[model samples]
Target: MEIRVLGIGCARCNELEKRVKDALAELGIAANVEHVTDLKEIAALGVLMTPGLVIDGKVASQGKVPSKDELKKLLGGGK
Candidate 1:
């Protein structure tokens, strides 16, 4: 699975990436996680806010960080 964290390298953006990594580690699911810092790319993804979470190329969450539990529910168990 591919997960993209869109942000301009702010603290919240970094924290979101950490949370995503933690979630992946907890779930034991291997995914390609990328941090998007380019304004053009972020805008192309239709994210007007930082800390946007994109799973499998589709926008999952925007404007805020999601909890690890919430991430598990969103990503599911065992891939």
Candidate 2:
């Protein structure tokens, strides 16, 4: 599965990435988690806000960070 974290390298974005990683580890799921920092690319995804989460090319979360449990639920669907 592919998971992308969209942000301009902000603190919240970093935290969101970390939580995603942690969630994946705890769930024993292997996914390609990428950090997207380019504004143009992010905007192209219809994300006007930073710290967006994308799962398998689908926008999951926008403008805010998701908790570990939430991430687990989102990522767990990959199984």
What's the residue-level lDDT of 76 in candidate 2? 91
Q: Which structure among the candidates has the greatest TM-score?
A: 2
Off by over 4 Å in 2: none
- Per-residue lDDT tens digits of candidate 2, residues 1-79? 9899999989999999999999999998888999999888899999998899999999999999988998899889866
Tens digits of per-residue lDDT for model 1 on 1-79?
9899999988999998999999889888899999999899899999998889998888888999888899887777324
Residue pairs of candidate 1 with colliding backbone atoms: none
TM-score of each: 0.93, 0.95
Model 1 score (lDDT)? 0.88
Best by lDDT: 2
